[model samples]
Target: MSALDRSAATPARVWLIWVALVVALAVPIAAAAASPLLAWRGPVYIAAGFAGIAALALQLVQPLLAGGHLPGLSAYRGRRLHRWVGALLVLAVVIHVAGLWITSPPDVVDALLFRSPTPFSNWGVIAMAAVFAVALLALLRRRLRIGPRLWRIVHMTLALVIVLGSIVHAVLIEGTMETMSKVALCALVFVATAKVVADLKGRAKRSASP
Candidate 1:
């Protein structure tokens, strides 16, 4: 195709991808909202569950932003948004656990202590720890003067933990999240994380080649 034709096609393709991503992220949340589960839970519990859901949705966006895959966003802007969204993710997790604690102190305590009867609780706690570690390390990055390579390794490793642990935690629980929607969300989260990791690795390999 001619350069003009290719140029014209590019924006349309980007817009289509953006719309698809927005729709994919929206469907699961909409399904959860329409579920009977939301009505069954009290406000605090509902808030907690939705907080977790919001975090999961943010997870889908985080990697895309970090990888500069979202059209029209410069890499700098994307990374800036990624940092802000990371902070928000941490806050969502805090609200999720705190709300659950208020609703059932014993359960929250057990989960934190890794003694919860529910397997999902253990995974949630693991993910929570990984989130906290990531935030803490980010804050200390400059102070610690971490080498770029080391920082990327640490960040990506924790990211993997966050993605996997969060997915397992969300999937194992028979709670506020509707099953089909929850599954769909988890799948998308995995895909997003995998794509970013793959892209990052490929870039690293290219850079390393003589």
Candidate 2:
């Protein structure tokens, strides 16, 4: 096999890549927490915010795009990995939003109930609600008897909605997101969402082919 293929095939390399990403994520968090003044604060917080949102976006996209990945590592292991990672993603999003609320409670409250005058606030609320709904569905998945195919479809659709709302919110926010890191992270969310849709379309096409 080619060198690139060999490297990609190595689970150890995949684990290393994940570890590297975790470390890379910590760097910006440290930087953001260092500032005090409003001008200095926005970029830092924005970078951190992007990390949390990205985590949620990745988690939301995983089941639909690569739900069976964990099993390939070990028998029946994929489902457990999926559950753990998905829960972690949800927790990250909660912490992200909570941080925003802590920084500006009044604004958050206004945003949450749709009374906020800002354009981004409405979109943020919608995205937050979509994430909450996805969590609810996951919690009630067994009781709902949502078949795998149907569940995947609904989950992806909601994920798309969340990403769209989040992008609008981020784009409209004037603070905490000026740095290149924050911009790239938001872009990744959009790209990830587009990829999910593309994957779903590809599956549909294959299924329809004679």
Candidate 3:
């Protein structure tokens, strides 16, 4: 292709990437916004619920950012943004649990302690723990003396935990999120992360070879 053709295509490709991401993230939240259940909930509960939806949607972005799959973002910048998004994700999870605690401390305690009757509760707690572990490792990366490739592997593994656990937790809950959109979001997250992890693993293997 000529320089003119390439230049013309670049902006369009960037827009396409961004437009798709926006649709993927926004549809679930939009579905939740229309949910009839929100009318029965209080302000705190609604906020907390949306925070969770936000967190779930943010999961899709994390792998894309980390893999530098999003257009117009370099690998370094994307990974930097990935760290910030990870922090925001933690904050969302905190709000989710804190709000639930405010409404029902015993339930939240049971969930955290792995004593909850609901199966989703256990998965949620497990996912939350993995998230915290990943964040702590990222913060202490230098202090822990972990190499970059090893760090990526650990991060990817924990990230898979977070994504899968969150999927199960959300799917099992009969709450605000619209069913189809929620499932679609989860599938996209699964695919995106799987792609990134596969690529990273392939690169690692090639690096180790002659």
Candidate with the greatest TM-score versus the true structure:
3
lDDT of each model, Cα atoms only?
Answer: 0.88, 0.63, 0.90
Candidate 2 worst ten-residue window by lDDT: 63-72
Model 2: CA > 4 A from native: 1-20, 23-31, 34-79, 96-104, 208-210
Better of 1 and 3 by lDDT: 3
The candidate that wins on lDDT is: 3
lDDT of 3 by residue, 1-210 (tens): 223533555788979989999999999999999999999999999988998899898999998888777777666778789999999999999999999889789999999999999999998898999999999999999998999888978998999999999999999999999999999999999999899899889988999999
RMSD of each candidate? Answer: 3.1, 5.2, 2.9
Ranking by TM-score: 3, 1, 2
By TM-score, how accurate is candidate 2?
Answer: 0.69
**What shift in Å separates residue 161 of candidate 2 from its native position after superposition?**
1.4
What would the TM-score be for candidate 1 when compared with the true structure? 0.92
lDDT of 1 by residue, 1-210 (tens): 223533555787879979988997888788778878776789999889889998888899989888777776666777899999999999999999999999999999999999998999998899999999999999999999998778988999999999999999999888767788789889988998999988888977888798
